[model samples]
Target chain A: MAEFWMSEIIKECARQRISLAEYIIRGECENSGSTREQVIEKMGKMLDVMSSAANGGLEAPIRSNSGLTGGAAYQYHQYIGQGSSLLGTVMSSAVEMALSCSEVNAAMGRIVACPTAGSCGIVPAAVLSVGVSHQKSREDMVMALFVATGVGMVIGEHATLAGADGGCQAECGAAASMAAAAVVNLMGGSDEQALHGAAIALKNMLGLVCDPVCGLVEIPCIKRNAIGASTALVSADMALAGVQSYIPFDEVVTAMYAIGKQLPAELRETGRGGLAVTKTGLAMYETLFGTPMSL
Target chain B: MNATYMTGSYSVFDITGPIMVGPSSSHTAGAARLGKIARILAHNSVKKVTFQLFGSFAQTYKGHGTDKALLAGILGLNPWDLGLRDAFSLAEKQNVEYIFEPVTKPTQQGWENYHPNTVRFLITSENGEVFDIVGCSLGGGKVRIISLNGILVNFTGESPILVTRHYDGPGIIAAITSILYQDKVNIGNMRVDRKRHSTTADMYLELDSDVTERVVEEIQKIPGMLNVILLQRINEDQSLNNIE
Candidate 1:
């Protein structure tokens, strides 16, 4: 129950020439995990983040400083006004993240699949933000990824990072949390801030769901990462500025799971509840997908 | 069966290989790391080498031009050398002999910890000296020297000096450092590590100085001594270093 020291993790990795994935995966396997299980678990948690963000996130309920609501593009415009070009870059990259996987699914062979097809952008978007914003060298990128692996391990332990278990709140919310923690660490966020960022992200996205229009990860999953990233930056900033979450990280994860189960199956990513159930959503689904979607 | 690779955004992972270049990425970049690892094992003597590889590496060693890589790495080539492209064919350029073996069997249990696509080089020199190195390519053109002999040594080329390990007692560090001290070799920092609570061990010396062939041979003679690091810096006059 000792606190995980990012510096020690990095130093250990430096003394060894293994990637964070290999290092953590090796540790997990040593502790009795199959390779397939580890990658799948990571995917599942990330998908939750995307799926939740596609549904309404707490950021929506919070006061938006900008009133630039037009279409999907308008959300991007909001991210741009949030001050940091890095935020804008992350949001744009999130779009690219979704498109890349779609292309990869369409083209390149996958080592493995993403959490769902929808939220594939979250991890990659967050990873790129570190390289771009912090100007991490190639080796540093590798090291940061290792640090990220550790943070993700903690998240996977603390929360249900999957939409199936905790709706998108645990899923995309957790992914953004992991991503935020990593970017903050790379950009010199203290260990306290990094963990705090993750906690705050979970607190904000407590009861999200996976309601893709017409049951696809494409329509909303991509945009969700961008918005989630914006919130991640805000949460990380708050944590960095000495705003601390009173709830322990483990408790937040447990609460997320409880809240997720309370959600009807319709909201658990079946695209059967919430937005998918609304008349307007149904109309949009019929127009975009087909009539008689239920049949 | 699992070739896992994670290419972070904006990063390049050139796993593609079997080129006409003197040293293929898998062979040259990967091989030098392998050879350097070999030097780390066997107390860094590496009197001779018997290398084993699986599948693709075994099949296309020649065409992929891994020979140049093995040759230079066996000769201990610089990682960034353009000439390394020809290492497979040009190993004769270094006057070192190598015999390759293809391992058709799946890795032994617990060996699962190592890479599936691995090259285990068993090396020795003219004096009946010996070394063994385990090498793996972890995508993005990055290579890892997993183990030396039986001891695990991590080599990232972060420091320029090589490492050697043997029965650890008095004068080991002194024997190595004294030579460097005598040669005016500057020690930047060292990553000397021991496993199993300090029984047999390896010490990675990142010297501001360099190692010569003569130094390696002399270090080979010490009692209970294993190997000496085989690091020879290429003279600093290559155009490739300044590439845009």
Candidate 2:
């Protein structure tokens, strides 16, 4: 099994003259002891789940048990129908799809957590919305997942994916970066361009905290996923247009981990600070679970 | 700091914990999985069970649905099961009496180094057989069974596993390995844990794929082996159905 750093992955792609997807698939097969066909089948299953979640989230926007989030995705969809938005159909749909997944999660419905359940919506929202709008083939979408997984692997190898360990940046920021690279790959960008997309997406989200109100993955989490998808799309656009990030993807991930560590314990999913500590946030908690003893 | 997050090999599915009903993966999904595996290990109809939660699990169990998820798992439901929401009522219908208790840490006497998400199960079967198991939820719906009845053991539901308990002696591992080789079941990894070296021991082997019933019988016939349990991989386990 081959382990790759950012430099090694780039070099292997160049030397082997294989696409980044193939390099990643080969490494995955070797490490997991599964055949290429098996890995592809698993990726196919994942794509199916993502599509189901997006549709389910929108088709029935049930309120969460906490009542902190629900029906917002549907409202966003309704707004798109009004033609009152500046964002295009693709971008608007992506944001709505992202919100759909998070809302579904909050309602105790099924969702695929791309990295963590708190940041579940970013990759699927970006991939499915953009893929459907552009009419990308199933095989192309599966290839896109390999790209996303490859980038996720590098981040998982070098940085934390758990918010408790590295804050919201490690979860949502890492997921958006993964989605950016995947979107670039789906659009026929070079591997180098894909890495740049990831770097640009992550660079913009440095030091993002993970302060879910009342310790639930609703409230800001659902909206943040929407913004994360938009960030992914915009970063992909810049990378495809030949914009370069001064810091590479690996360094950006390293910085994300460092910044997450520097975050106060209150800001790292403890529900003691940030939005969780706000007057409105406390009031919502009081309404739902009753007044917290500390407050 | 070295600035690295490398841990172990991850499948593409690892990035996405298989489609699950959840408000939280560590608390809900992981708790369900622990319940499901404990049900299988019990090997008989569960009459009653008690869950002792430690640290983080004890802190926020009710709000996170950990309580419901755990009961749902004991009744043979997966994390993706919509019925998870009704697990409390379902447990009563199934005649599976259950209770939850909070503990600051593992009070199993000798065991230390507990994961904050750890839970200990004391399960009693209809046949009046009783057993104790300890497991830890490692976030993202992943779990590891760390012990059984105070004996050290190891298992993660990632692949097919063959767990055996036997008197600690010689050639026990080789006997199982030879049968697996003949059956063409590739061994992914193996771990042996004993209360005392050369005494009673538990053997855990992860297989690349499933083994046939005939192969299992052959291993069960080994001289020193007392009990053998075959556990399917989480995906292959029929307890979970894909939502879509």
Error of 1 at B183 (Å): 53
Report the C-alpha lDDT of model 1 over B90-165, residue by residue, as the tens digit. 6565456778776766666233347634678877765786666677754323476766656565555433556687
Write the residue-wise lDDT of candidate 1 on A79-181 in tens digits.
5556544634645544444333322221111211222223334545555554665666544444444444455455444455446456777556766666666
DockQ of each: 0.01, 0.39
For candidate 2 chain B, the 10 contiguous residues with the lowest summed lDDT are B1-10
Interface RMSD of each: 17.0, 4.3
Residue B131 of model 1 has an lDDT of 62
Instruction: List candidate 2 stretches off by more than 4 Å.
Output: A1-3, A290-295, B1-8, B104-113, B159-243
What docking grade does candidate 1 earn?
A: incorrect
lDDT scores of the candidates, listed in order: 0.52, 0.83
- The numbered model that scores best in TM-score is 2
